[model samples]
Target: MTVLEQTGRRPAALAGLWGGLALTSGVALTATSGWLIVRAAERPVILTLLTAIVGVRAFGMARPLFRHLERLRSHDSALADLATARTEVYAALIPLTPARLGRRSRSAVLAGVVDDLTDVVESHVRVRVPVLSAGVAALFAILLTGALEPGAGVLVATWSALVVLLARWGLALEREAQPLLGAARAEVSRAAELVARHTPRLQAIGAAGDVLTRLDAAHTGLARALRTQSRGRALVTGGVLVLTGVTTVVMAVIAGRAELPSAVTALLVVVPAALADTVLPFADAVRAQARAEQSRAGVETLLDQTAAVADVGRGRQSSTAPHLRLEGVSAGWVEGRVDVGPVDLDLAPGRRVGVVGANGSGKSTLLAVLARALDPASGRYLVDGRDVTELAADAVRELLAVVDDEPHVFAADLRANLALAQPDASDQDLVDALRVCGLESWFDALPDGLGTRIGSGGRGVSGGERARLALTRAVLSRRPVILLDEPVAHLDHATATSVMRDVWAATSGRTVVVVSHRHEGLDAVDQVIDLTPTRKD
Candidate 1:
């Protein structure tokens, strides 16, 4: 089903109603004004002209009034649909988070989803309202002119068909250009994000020039696609104006031959000009339709995958620190590509295990499975000797706290950011958690301490600090199992070792699983599991 169809029908209908009224009023005003002017030129008696004068005045007033109402209704409906679409899409993505999203650069994928949703929802206002309004006004014109003179009616009908044909051609062009446009946009986004987040590092490593070159290339491609798309709209716009001119001349000639009344002839001549406003917007509507179609396809593709795991039942909660085990557990981010495991492991309470593997050997994948962010494709992942697949996913998640390399620092007070891990935590508890994560010096340096606002728009956080902040949150959660997925990956060797030291010191009594390719932190763990896959020749 189309994305527009998924947004409820009532708002769309109301928008159409308002838009149609506005367009109809404008056409009527133009036609009546033309008739009034012609009748006045004939020196009609004042009394005889009263009705036409009153019609012209009423139509003129109604035009703006209806247009104002149309604007309000259309925008309100679009915003409402946007709100609903965002909520529904977010809910649908919860189960697919991190795994189906992508192995890396999940934020970029999510950002694309947001853009697509906006495009799809915006179609209600941009495409549907305009098309519906034009359709209604054109129908009114056809019926009115047909009653006055069948020849004029035929001329208008033929002109309308040509306009529709033009719009269709424009839509085809826009559709053909959409994929290229979308790719260009994605490249721009990826490049911009990379530069923004790592500008200093890129420059320090002397790779800044290469990244900027890529950004320039992406922008150039985007410009070319936009130019191609604009040609379609230009064709439609020029065609509509040209057609309107031809139709007006044809109507005037036909009216003269029919021996129509002067006022009627004037109305017939002016009708095409009035209809130009309605027809011109069809170019924009066609372009919007093409964009909406592409965006809808993207949203559908992302949401089509089945959830990684099912919530079978609420399941029994673990009493104290429960035993977790992975027995020959094989899993993959994508189907039919098992990237990790066909092995055995056990996690007793308070056990500290480290996972080490080369790139693509699936260190993070194993951690994701353990953290309940992913489900195993084969074999059993048991919690307290029972298969976790039979239990509620949320219940399994509740027992674990995850600290990944990239942890988001929300745009709020320092207290609120840390409080996400433990909402009921006191200020002292928060401070202690930071101290344990080796952020004590940084916390002390903060001007507002716990009240400091630090995120996108607030105080900047260094990479090491961000990693420590994540560790602080994990420490505060007090979950039985703390899964660290390369939490210190971004830090230098010395800092990584220092952070790992504090991590081990902070979570001394919990079941900790640290996944890392670096050897800096592995020495502190009780056991190290090497995930290097054995190849059979």
Candidate 2:
């Protein structure tokens, strides 16, 4: 979690070693460059000697640069792994108190990937590269100046402060831009979430225009904020040029009259630009700092939520293994009231069962609890003669699949959609899956076959097809346990019958618990779990 740490550590202790090597190499590049300029000022003999010395610095840098690149690669891989680790936290955080994450979470995560990660890489590189390069460059510059004339050495030292000042001025402008840009991105995230959450209600009420109004307002705010930040960054750049020009003029005057020859004068004056370039990364660093703060806080929140719900406080499983069981598993539809089911229960493996209920019964919540997608207020869940607490939840998730009443079909081709369930599935395997789901003909008849791209949220497909497709994924996985909350709730008579037939066929030897309002859908099931709604005042 402490991404930027410098502890005596185990994971990639080589980060420090890489940092040192990169610093050493960058210094050599700077020193070589300055020496080449200084030596070229003298006669051919001196020029020849200076040129070789300059070239030596280049050669000296090669090994360090190679090692540093390896380090960069290691750190980048570490960062990516960290991202994967954070994703697990997000998965764990959902189904805690809330039902789903803010849709803005997707874009926020993307921003962290697209811009925030870049900020870390650039910030580290900038902080390392410039200081090392300039330090080496400045040291050589001073030595050359002192040898030529003490007055020139003193002048070089004086102008170094001006360069640092200019860097600070540029940094201030960049600092302001970073926060403004961060604010704009946050607004965009919030607006995206608002729209995703309200889309269903908006369609129901024909109030889509109101959703557009919210979107437009958020976009307008973001656009205005970005423009302001862009203008500020532009101003900083202009200031950099002005500062660079003034120093060049002052140094030019001093070098032109000094006893040192033209080449030495050039080295004394021209080399400062490289030094200036060194500190330039600070402007970028400022923005990185702001974005990193926002992302890190987001990650922290996610981790904290994970820690809060962890089974650490509960006892581990020992005897009396129940394929599934829940104790004190209480939660509610509307926070304090309408709560249901602290029911202690158990089920056997490979048992087919039906969860029957009228509207508002706690049937669906029970399915969620068994799926490990929802946590009970307090409970013990056993799977496969072992306590679930004994397994990493992520690994446990791989063991079960759910077919919700409404399922999301990615805006992707048929093959791509199926691949989400099993990325390495063969073509024939996909064809077999389609066949089992009664969708093979529908897919094969398409102009693009499995390559036909569906519209967003299955726009180009019918609701029944979407339902079947989602069911297909769960069926194909053939997980140890399958929870079908409402596999055929939206299908018409004939279509529902076909889907239900396949459901029964595929689940022949699997453990399955289905929840459905359709009596016909459950007529063939082993036992019916009757969860009638409690009468309300």
Candidate 3:
């Protein structure tokens, strides 16, 4: 789907028309001022001078009026189109979410997508407006000058064409430098991220200097790439200034040679100078176009894949006590490679299973499969004696609640955060879930109980509270199966143990599978399965 504004063409065109009128008013203002000054010097009649004064005042007032209208129309159109484009891009992004977003932190990938989408939408205002306004102004100047003096009109047209050629060249230069600039910036970011995240490890390995040297090198490269990018803008600006000066002088010569009146000649001579303002903004517009193109390409590349899991099956619901079984289920984030599984397991109702493994053993990947966030490469994932692939992914997902290490609490009141799991849940239900998940004491301490704000920019929550809040969501969801993928991984040993005790208690009578690389709370599980990845052929 095209994220750029296609449907709002009429409004954009109307905005451009207003912009053209504003620019035309400026051109007329300049020309009429020159004529009025020349006519006054010649001691023209009071009546003639009166008309010139009124014309100048009219043009001056019209310029700002048209400009205001242009801004209102253009901004309203751009904002409406931006809203639509963002919605389309976000909808496209939903299916590919966590599984296809790669192994890097989801925040970084998602943040980049948001930035690119904004850049794409901004093209309408930055690139389209300037181009259309310049076109209108240039066309008016050429026609008005050509009517009085064809030679002057040809000069104006040539200057406009040269300006366009220079802009195209600058755009090409900017495009060429884009990939190099991106690579250099990415290298700098990588170096900085490495230093920030692993400073102690690098220092311990006695490689801090080397990492610093690499970081310095990355910065140097980034500076060099930036210099290269600026050349395009410089070329467009310098070339346009030179061309405008030449056009203005030529316009004077043509007006001096023509048989027009002295006042009219003065008007003709200054027309090119007035139109210079219309053409000079092309440099910035060209650069915005190049950036928008790059951003659009980046967004397309990031989203140009089939979803990792298909969701085309019938929406089948399971019993209150669902039985989840994974038989030889192997899956990977990328194709043709197995990241986890080829193991067998059975989860009857209310059975608690603990999954333990080293970092690369695919403990989280197993939980993802059980939660229907991933489809197995080979083997069956059965829910209530039926292959899960036969059921809609969302339907299967609804039967399960999966909590990961990082639980996000939105910036809202205490009750609003839990209500997302059960949108129609009552105040008593919310209070009971929080009480069951060991947040009773914390809730009571709140100044406003359910109305107490939490999450970002709100009240701060401890690591233990965050974990319990996630449990409260699961309890509120009332899903038959609870899947915990390192939910307590961030907590200390004692906190992790206490949180797990609450987790098990809150999820009573529900099938539970907890995956952990650490052994903080494995003792409470009914069965602890140690996952060791088998070597591939």
Q: Choose the strongest candidate by lDDT.
A: 1
lDDT of 2: 0.62
Report the poorest 10 consecutive residues by lDDT, candidate 2: 4-13
Look at candidate 1 and give me any clashing residue pairs.
none
lDDT of 1 by residue, 1-537 (tens): 344466836676777777787888889889988998988999978998899889888888887887788788878878888887888788888888878886446776778888888888888888888887888889999999999999988898998889999899989999999988888887898899889999999999999999999999999999998898888888899999999998899999999999999999999999999999987888888888888899889889888888887766668665669899999999898989998988578999999999988899989889889878788989889999888877888888889999887899999999999999999999999998998888989999999999999998999998888888998898899888999988878889888888888889889899999988888878778899999977899
Per residue, candidate 3 scores C-alpha lDDT tens digits across 184-213 of 988998999999999999999999999999
Model 1 ranges off by over 4 Å: 1-4, 184-224, 310-314, 422-432, 533-537
lDDT of each: 0.87, 0.62, 0.86
* lDDT tens digits by residue: candidate 2, 1-537: 544333113333344345434544454455455556566555467646755675666657674675566467556755664565546544544545333333334444445544544444344443444344455555655666667667666666766666556555645655566666667767777677767887888789988787788778878888877776555445545555566566667776777877556555655565446445544544554445445555555545544543322443243433222266556566444445444576665567667788878876887877766766555655566665566667655555666788888787778888888888878888888888777777877887788777888868543878677877887787668676778888878778887877778777766777778888886567777778777856799
Candidate 3 weakest lDDT stretch, 10 residues = 1-10
For model 3, the stretches where C-alpha displacement exceeds 4 angstroms are: 5-8, 534-537
Put the candidates in lDDT order, highest first. 1, 3, 2
Candidate 3 TM-score, true structure as reference: 0.95
Question: TM-score, each model?
Answer: 0.89, 0.68, 0.95
Question: How far out, in Å, is residue 364 in model 1?
Answer: 0.5
